[model samples]
Target: MSTNHEELTRLARTLNPQIIDEFRANRGKMKNFPGPEFLLLHTHGARSNQPRTTPLRYIKEGDTYILIAANGGAPRNPDWYYNILAHPNDVTIEVETEQLNVRATVAPPAERDRLFAEVVRQAPDFAKAQKGTSRTMPIVLLECVTEKD
Candidate 1:
């Protein structure tokens, strides 16, 4: 069996780019990954400092976008999670036809359950993914950043 690291690597190098390409080419809609709202999250790698773009499913709360670091219910958090922690100020996201500067923050423990439950209610697959892993999924909030340059 392939290790989780290997699987994540394969996905990062292959499927991620395909999704990203389709997302941009189609004005942010992914045909292959339908259902559940999608967003393109741009982050810098924590170790290499190289740019990384990850396609994530999100649930929006008002103007804030909520993303879960479920890693498809793998044994570990996705790489972008660490990336956000290391460079929270340098994150941005693509939604629909607009690209927006955004800040990433992990939801506090007290609030995570409520958010996670809502996600499961809308997208039941997340509940199944959660059952497959031992670690709790982290809820990440991405809020728009407006800076006058």
Candidate 2:
């Protein structure tokens, strides 16, 4: 598979909103074609302050939503990663019809390693992604913040 950044960005910008809506409407049953395990994440752009969404591979560890900043094994992290890093408080996320308010944080080294291992086990492409880049991919944890009913 080609890992061209511009092409991926174009494809993502063009295809992600629809995918996210479909995934949301279908409760995550609908996924990216070819890569069935990836899910789209919608977030506010930290710098532009515009809404941004990207397809990402995620795993659930109990209540926490785990994601990796692999960016298809890019040399630099994804924009969304920096966005969340700049604003660690509460960010909105949508996963298969469930809109959540969550706090995003980079997992500690040990935890990141463990979570990354689990993710690689579930989706072997992650391992390939890791190998494609020299930068250490970060394991980002999105913890849902409960709203009082």
TM-score of each: 0.92, 0.84
List, residue by residue over 1-149, the lDDT tens digit for candidate 2: 65587776777688777876676677777644544255556566788877667766588999888998888777889898988886766476767657777878899999998998898888889899899889999989988887511
Candidate 1, position 7, lDDT: 80
Reference-based lDDT, each prediction: 0.88, 0.77
- Clashing residue pairs in candidate 2 are 24-96, 24-97
Backbone N/Cα/C clashes per model: 0, 2
Candidate 1 lDDT over 1-149, as tens digits, reads 99866786787788877888888899987777655889999899999999988889998989999999988888889999999999998998999889899888999998999999999888899999899899999999988989511
Q: Summing lDDT over every window of 10 consecutive residues in candidate 2, give the lowest-scoring window.
A: 31-40
Judge candidate 2 against the unseen true structure and give its global Cα lDDT, from 0 to 1: 0.77
After superposition, candidate 2 runs with Cα above 4 Å error: 1-3, 31-40, 147-149
lDDT of 2 at 45: 76
Error of 1 at 127 (Å): 0.8
